[model samples]
Target: MQQQTNYSNELSGKIALVTGGTKGAGKAIAERLKAAGATVVITARNKPDQADPDLYFVPADLSKRGAADSVAKATLERYGRLDILINNLGGSETPAGGFAALNDEHWESTISTNLLAPVRLDRAFLPQMLENGNGVIIHIASIQGRLPLYDATLPYAAAKAGLINYSKGLAKEVTSKGLRVLTVSPGWIKTENVKYFLERIARSSNSSIEEAQQSVIAALGGIPYGRPAEPEEVAELVGFLASPRAKYLSGSEFVIDGGTIPTI
Candidate 1:
C-alpha cells in the first residue's frame, strides 16, 4: 500500500537523459523523472515499440564511438541544457561459461556497453553541467561487480567493477564543481528479461521456476529479503537521489541488494 499525493514539481525546468530507457529499470527511471516534472529524453538503439509522446527519443547505440556525442548534441540543441544523466544501458550477452569460454570480442563488447558507454556520455555532457554549476549523473551498476557469478556474467561483472571505480573517482573530481556523480548497484531485479531468464533456466535445468529462483539466490549466497527487487523499487531510490533533497549526497555507491552481499 502506497500513499498518493499531489506531487511537487521538484524537477520542473530541468532536463534528463536516460539511456536504454525503452524497457526495464531504465523505463521505470525515465517515468519517475517525468513524474518529478523533468523534460525527459531517452536513447536506445531503436524507437520504443509503443508510442510515448511525452518523451523525446534519440536512436543511437551507446556502445559505438560517436553515439554519445551525437546524443548530447541533439539534446542540447533541442533543450539547451541537461540536468540529469542516467547511465542504465548494460548487460551480458556473452555465452554462459568461465573465462576460457569468453573470447576477445565478448570481453570488448561487454566492457564497451557496461563501462565505456557511460564514460563517453559523461564526458560529452559534463561540460555543460559544469558551466551551469549543478547536475546529477547516475551510473546503474550491479551487485555482480562485487559478488560475481563467474559462470555466466564474468565480463559484465568485470566491466561493472571498472564502472564502479570510475564513478567514484569521477564523483570525487566533480562534487567540488557542483556536479553530483553517484552509482546505484542493484541485485537481481524483477524485470521482463529476468523473468524470461528464470523460465529458461527452469526448462534447461528440469526444475520448477521456484527452484530456478532459489538457485540464483544460492549463487549469490542468498538474498535475505527473500525475493528480487522490483524495477520500480530501484527507480524510487533514483528519484530521491536526483531530487534537491539529496543535495549533499554525492560520490557514493548506493546498493539496493536486499542484503544479498553477506559482508558489511
Candidate 2:
C-alpha cells in the first residue's frame, strides 16, 4: 500500500474509480494509482480479503444496472471529482463445455458481467469526465475475445469482443470531449479466478492441479512465456495508461500476455 504512489505526471491529484478493485488486478490498479498520488476508490459486491482502512471501498453488485449509477454517484459525493476510471469488473460465471452447455440464463449472465457492467458504469461516469474535458478510462479485456475458447467460454469471449469494440467506439465518441478510452487485453492471469477455474477443471477431470493448469495453457495454444501474468504487471500498465504520459494513447488495445496470441 505504501509503495504504490509514484507518478509520471498524468495521475497527480486525480480522483479515480476502480470497479472490482478490492482484489486481483483491480486491487493492484487501485494501489498503483494511490502510489501515483491519485485518490483511489474501489467497489465490489462484498468486502474483499485485503481491505484496508485508508482505501475507499464501495460495496455493490455491479451486475445490477442501478449499481453502476449508484457507485458513480457515490464517487462524486465522496470525492467531488473523478479523473480516472478503471473498469475491471468482469468474469464468466458459467462453466465450460460448448454452446449446448450454456442456458439462456448463463448466456445473459456472461454478457451482463463481461460486457454490460462497464458499459453502464461508463454511462454513469463519462458525462462528468466529458464535461470536465479531460480524463482516462481503461477497460480490462481478454485475448479470448479474439481467440475464442469455443468449448467452454464462447459467450465470455463474445462479450469481451464486444467490450473491446465498445471501448474503441467509446474512445472515438469521447476523446474530442477529453476522455481517453482504451482496453487492456490480458491473455491469461494467475488470479484467484484462475485458481477457481483450475480447481473446477481438476474436479471435473481425473487430473492433478498441475495437469489442469497445463490443460488450460494448451487450450490457450501454449503461452510462449510458459506462465500466466502477475496481476501487478497488468496493474503497472493500467498505472501508466492512466497518467499524463499516455495522453496521446487512446482507442488502442494493449495485449500483455507474455507473447501469447499468435496474431498481431
Candidate 3:
C-alpha cells in the first residue's frame, strides 16, 4: 500500500497576511496557508461574501494613501508578527485602446495598485521580519509584465514589469538578512473576474464561451497548455514557497502561465 503524507501542520505556528484575499487567487492562498496550519490574515476593500471564522479579514483600499501602514499596524497589533506576506492585490480598469487612450490617472492608479502597494506594505512589515531574521514576501505579478498587450492592459503591464524589477532588487538587498522576496507572475488565471470577462467577451462578440476563451488565448499569443490555471494551483505554489521546503529559494521569479510567454 502506498502511504499518503499529511501536511496539515507544516506552518503550524506561522502568521501570514494576504492582500486582496476576499476572493480569487488571494482567497485560495489564504486558505492554503491556513490549511498548512498558519494563522492567516486577509485584507481587501470589501468584506468577503462568506466569512470564515478561521481567517482574519482586514478591510482597506491599499491603492489609497496610508492604507498599507494601517493594515500592517492592524496585523502586527493582532498577531505580534508576520511570517509570510503575500502582496496579491492588483487589477487594471483602463479601457481598451492603444497607448493614446490611457491618461495620467490611469497610469498612476495602475502603478499604485500593481507596484507601489506592495512596496508600501513591504516597507511597513520589513522591520519586524528583519528583526526576527526570517520571513517570506511574495509579490503576485502578471506575465503581461513581459508579454504586454498594448491595446488592453498597457498600464497594468508596465506596472507589473516595474514590480518584477523591484522584486528582484529587493531580493538582492534582503536575502542575506533571511527574508525571502520573490515574484510569481501568472499568465491567464480563471478567477471569478476572468470568468465574467470571458462571458462579456462571448456576449459582445456573439460567440460561445469556448470561442471567447480561444479568442483571448489567441490575443495572448496562445496559452500552450490550452487552459488558464486554477486559483488553487497558484495557491499551492505560494504555500510551498512559504514553507520550510523552499528555504534555499530566494531572489527569483516563478512564472505560472501554462507556457503562455513564448520566449525563454
lDDT of 2 at 261: 92
For residues 110-174, write the lDDT of model 2, one tens digit per residue.
Answer: 89888999999999987888788998889999999898887677889999999999999998998
Candidate models: Cα lDDT each: 0.92, 0.87, 0.92
Query: How do all models score by TM-score?
Result: 0.94, 0.95, 0.94
Q: What is candidate 1's lDDT per residue for 136-230, written digit by digit as tens?
A: 99999999999998766899999999999999999999999999999999999988788776775677578898898888899999999988999
Q: Tell me how many residue pairs clash in candidate 3.
A: 0
**Which portions of model 3 show Cα errors greater than 4 Å?**
1-5, 199-212
> After best superposition, candidate 1 residue 191: deviation in angstroms?
0.9
Runs with alpha carbons beyond 4 Å of true place in candidate 2: 1-10
Tens-place lDDT per residue, model 3, 1-264, is 999878889999999999999899999999999999999999999999999999999999999989999999999999999999999999887766578878999999999999999999999999999999999999999999998877667999999999999999999999999999989998899898886777656766688988978888898998889889999999999999999989999989999999999989
> After superposition on all CA atoms, what RMSD does each candidate show versus the true structure?
2.8, 3.5, 2.1
* Model 1 CA lDDT for position 171: 96
